[model samples]
Target: MKTSAADTPPRKRVIVLIAAGLSVLLLAGIGVYGLIQGPRTGPPPDNSEADGPAATAAPEDGTQTPGRIVPVERSSDPETFARNVATAVFAWDTGAGFMPLDYTAVVMEVADPTGTEQAGLANDLAAYLPVREAWVDLRQYATTQHLEITDAFVPEAWATAQAQAQPGQITEGTTAITIEGVRYRAGVWNEKPVASEHEVAFTVFVICEPAYDTCHLLRLSELDNPLR
Candidate 1:
């Protein structure tokens, strides 16, 4: 007898339904695997193995050195000392450059090694104002008169001095000095004044400590009377 739609067996229909479900599950598994291990598109062409982890680099020494804690030295350099003092008083004192220190700090740094008379210099620096219309001596200028100290900060002073030290088309000169078994011939910034504060001029010196460095200018033997 021929089979009709209503006469089809329930067992055969159940087998067909199970086969369709298994086929769908197989397709989903393959898609999931491809998503995870599939070839990457836009990464660097050199990295052919993009499916793996990134590689790291080694240092030039072939090994990494762990960081160590260290300390700083606070001593001074005679050459840098001279330059720093001069910079503090003359050009600009601030930053890695000359630092415009306060009366105490300036006296401490610019003390006369030839004499213990910085106390006197400090007292003298307290005697004048910065707004005067007269010429100030190296020693007196070394000693700041006005303790009002409106602007004795190092960076600020450096900016002020640099602003005052009109940057001249740099000229060239040299000077030599002997200190602690070392002879040095320093290049002086004696170039023509490219600035407004040519009220005074002096040679530069550098002071170095075991751990630090400072700049200063020589104490000029003569003085300029700007008001005259």
Candidate 2:
């Protein structure tokens, strides 16, 4: 007979609980603060100008060139830390000799030190980067991408979430900032450079100050699904 979820081993049960909690956090913005509950196209090559932000050409030997991977700069200020995290999330080059996970690591380096939120944060990062398969496809085109941030601010809804939370329901120093920016992607097509741009928005949650000397990422809202 099949074992029921309730009858699962203790270790397996904890894993399930963590996954369930992460899902709730990702899907519902309120769950994240309430309980801690928590693309593409255009332009010809412009050889005369700089290759685009973080852009790099694939190696001729068919070997991935490990391009420079810049880790997010840590900051004590919540807004500054959030902005850095947002930039790192959207910055990547398929031809830069790195996979999506490498870029993910850059941001994860500043994730919750307690490790309680790392798994959830990883899931959150996955939604922002290309999967391995897609990365390979884009690599063929020598594609590169980065974000041009227009604004970063604590959303009003965050205030509401905090007010509604029972004292201690939310971690002290934890806050949410909505990031507004334009995502720019550039690549070579038919040996010509092409580029495209789209407005994007997302919320970054972090804990700073007494939690740690520098802000640490906790979670992220769904892409273009940031709190107003």
Candidate 3:
């Protein structure tokens, strides 16, 4: 059988048509699956630094609970309180389905138990919530943050108040308490093939009213790039 040039379809055109059909089917399948499964809060791959050594060790049996913010303990000591807050704030996992708003609430509780102060803290949370959610949507939720508190000191005014305090005496609110430390942040976007790491020194301030047993975060300023 003899075929004319116009009678046979071009091989390249046929291949292109098949490829287009397959691509469309794949896209449809993805959409359908997304609708059926809903959002996934799964964490990143185990190879992530999250699987590495934590500030605290796991049980001797080598068992550990991953995902979700680890419970932070409250302490009367300003230094202890600040360290706990820093650890929790940096150690977040969107992959574990941690909502930004909820995480912010937990931070608020630790920094401002009385809820009557710390306007700066509130403002900062408001700004961060949206940015974090957007980053999570971009598949940039996998991250590791570590904090080490180098020193915590009471300011001059606060120190003076402590010195003047009599036995069983109630003192006015402390002017400020400062905590100095270093923080490490690492992030990976496997999809984008992007990785980032940074270490910086940070300072945080808290105000306390010992009489009411209340403390509120005032500021978290002063971040210096260690690499610089």
Candidate 4:
């Protein structure tokens, strides 16, 4: 039977509390991604000719060009599933006629089946994706972003957290995978193509196997902060 948050066991509650605290820290501006919050006044005025033609406008039908970002095929393999979730979390286009919530929905589609973690997972995504205001600001530059994963592993901290859990406190197949990657962003600035890249790391908590035939996302670590 599904249990309410108030009915969650003590150890499980501790884990959730820890994740919540991290979310608070992220919102407080600690380690916030600068690209999203940086100068929003649009590209500089002087580089018009050097930058190339202005980016093509979004389709009038309100559809993404190239293609919409979507998650990889579902997998029973924990590592594969974690990578899929990581990709879905980081891939987005501000000019794609989709809001941050649209991208958030992609990940939430595979969230905890019991619904226990969906709310927390939504909070987790908020830390990774720009808010609606920031999204609009980025759209002006026609910005799009994706991640190139460099490494993924079960971090030692996850093992430690597991060790502290009381029997049955954590779901049967739950695990945490830390993903390290380079975030790449591209857009038109002054009518010219411009791009930037930054290294990022985060932990994805998931459950797979006996818990379900395919893995499901549970929560995310603070951006640039991964279990190690």
Minimum summed lDDT over a 10-residue window in model 1 is located at 169-178
lDDT of 3 by residue, 1-228 (tens): 112334322222111222344344344332122112221233322223433332122123433344556666666566666666666655555444556666777777656443433454655544333344343443233554556667665544334433444432322332333445555545443323333444433334454434225444544532331101
lDDT to native, each model: 0.24, 0.69, 0.43, 0.67
Q: Candidate 1 — which residues are off by over 4 angstroms?
A: 1-77, 91-105, 109-115, 123-195, 202-222, 225-228
The model with the greatest lDDT is: 2
lDDT per residue as tens, model 1, 1-228: 112334322212111222333344233331211112222223222122111111111112433232321111122444434333433332211111122234235534544332223443333333211212211211112221111111111222222222333232110111112112111111112222111111232222222221122222222211111001
lDDT of 1: 0.24
In candidate 3, which residue pairs clash?
A: none
**lDDT of candidate 4 over 84-108, digit per residue (tens):** 8888888987776788888888888
Off by over 4 Å in 2: 1-64
Q: What TM-score number comes out for model 1?
A: 0.23
Ranking, lDDT, top scorer first: 2, 4, 3, 1
Q: How do the predictions measure up, each by TM-score? A: 0.23, 0.75, 0.49, 0.73
The candidate, 1 or 3, that scores higher on lDDT is: 3
- Angstrom error of the Cα, residue 213, model 4: value is 1.1
